[model samples]
Target: MDLNLIALIMGIVEGLTEYLPISSTGHLILVGSWLGFTGETAKIFEVFIQLGSILAIAVLYRHRFYSFLTLAQFQKKGLNLLHIFLGILPAAVLGFVFYDWIKTLFSPYVVVFALLAGAILMIAAQLAKRKVTAESLDQLTYRQAFLIGLFQTLALWPGFSRAGATISGGLLLGASYKTAAEFSFLVAVPIMFGTTGFDLIKNLDVLHPQDFGVFAIGFVTAFVVAMLAVVTFLKVLNRLKLIPFAIYRILLAGVLFYYLYF
Candidate 1:
């Protein structure tokens, strides 16, 4: 029950789930509750550690990010900065507007329903038989990006998952699995940074100097673990697609539901 041990466990959970469409925030909320670590400080800790996962994405896709710097490289690679902006705008605006209200919904009950709902959405997206027009990030259009952003607003619910919503939207809108996953990961960096940064600033009073060590432990652990997870997930996604993850989400939801209400 030591704080450091809790930090390590939560860091592992965050790293493993942050990009997997498995709702890392939901997992953290449930896990924190089980660990008896629920409170203002816990929320800030969760937000802080997410930066580590975001850094993992930024590192893994360094080339793509670097391309954003040069006009010729950006155009040659068909990378559109506008697409990223569009993908982030909808959720960013909504999350900012409802920040306090959303924080209050971070309960096990909300997470359970969200998990099942997101699972259903993922399943529907996979089964819906759509054309695959965008096989790669380069082929994605602005409208598709905007639509994915709109879908991302669903993630305002704790367990719906940012990656799940956006990727499912991409699949529904004619993108290949890889393309959707890639774009989801790409947009996640800025969105998470914005949200986490805002939360830290808003809750600065709750932080203590002693907690920095625990935060650092969680941060480094998430960064290293997420680096491995992101690579492995990308490979597995093409072969297995979203169905397996959807099933996992359903099972997880059922278990959590029973645990909570029984």
Candidate 2:
């Protein structure tokens, strides 16, 4: 496949999976490999293009973030900034500490096992009885936020979805599904931005003159598709169960394992 075509397909995959309980990085790695889009440039492309998806969230939730700039509102709420920082801390710290090691685990076999493990975790989270203590994002306590961050650390593994880990943690801590998903999307802004910025700075030399066209295609594709995915996901979440996603992950893992190992 051509590089531009590969970028478009992977961008679509990233947009669709980024906010879902399925791993975007895992899907990108798998799809990129299958499309022969592997290597340093491809990895950097994947990292940088996540900025586009982050922009989707920024655009969609601009009102919420806008309120943070007002002094009166800031005084009353003290900014969810504190909680958001607490939530992203574990993953940020640990991811940086073990960056190289995590990169090594990005192979197809590791991702296969990770997908299976993550599926089981999601299935278990679905089956577990949840008490709706925190029904809204504002109602979530600091402790819950911290715990959710710890859960997010699980996503350092390729196939362990950040949304999945946080949502499961939120559910286990008695948050409603709506609140859990909302919080997941909100917290992802900082995390994605931080990671992407770090990677971009570290690999600035990886860019070539020809890369901009493909990157722009990916960025736009991800932005448009992510908006659609987020809208549709929130609309149907109340009527849907996480079990189906888990089942889909399991099936995907099995298929990949068969082709890779058989």
Candidate 3:
């Protein structure tokens, strides 16, 4: 395979859409199809690029992550970690058990539906925003976290972006936009890292040292791009409304529909 070109394409997509409400997986799949990247390779490319977004959030939120682990924030340090682990457990289980079937569902047309459906949900979330609590994730109950986890499982289906589903779930469950968005970003680290690590293990025999270099380039590129995405999104989100993103989703889906038929 042409590693450099692959790195460049995946890096750009990973950087650009990883933080947005739009399904990053869906965009990668669409880009893959347009570029003729198919089968296992395409899935590998998509999953690997996801690591970039995860790393970006980890770096950007390093202070929060450190505080969450330290004695300063927690009376019982070990217990805090356990809660985080427990929250990640459900998604991990689901990923392992249904991994193959989930990837098989990726298609451009499904992305169109997901984009449109998610937009409608975003609009509804906007309306519902009035009733939501302004509670932070630290104030979140365990039951609420588990509910978000269940909602996250929906993202395993193509088009239902993980961040999109989780954020909407959080909002509906009473978390404010800032809290929901921040926690949603934090949860991504484990999910993406686990996914990338597992794929690397399964493909170890096939991955030569040069493949590692290519992966590194793509990983670094994705990280840089995602950092920018994270920063810009936070700023835009704080000052503006989610209506802009909702509109973007509708417009993108409309374009996809046109492309589908024309």
Q: Rate the local accuracy (lDDT) of all candidates.
A: 0.92, 0.85, 0.74
- What TM-score does structure 3 among the candidates reach? 0.85
lDDT, candidate 1, at 90? 96
Write candidate 2's Cα lDDT for 227-252 as tens digits: 89989998887788677888888888
lDDT of 1 at 260: 91
**lDDT top scorer:** 1
Question: Where does the lowest 10-residue lDDT sum fall in candidate 1?
Answer: 70-79
Clash count per candidate: 0, 0, 0
Ranking by lDDT: 1, 2, 3
Error of 1 at 107 (Å): 1.3
Those runs of model 2 whose alpha carbons end farther than 4 Å from true positions after fitting are: 77-79
Q: How close is candidate 2 to the true structure, as a TM-score?
A: 0.95
Name the regions of candidate 1 deviating beyond 4 angstroms. 73-77
- Residue pairs in collision within model 1: none
Give TM per candidate. Answer: 0.96, 0.95, 0.85
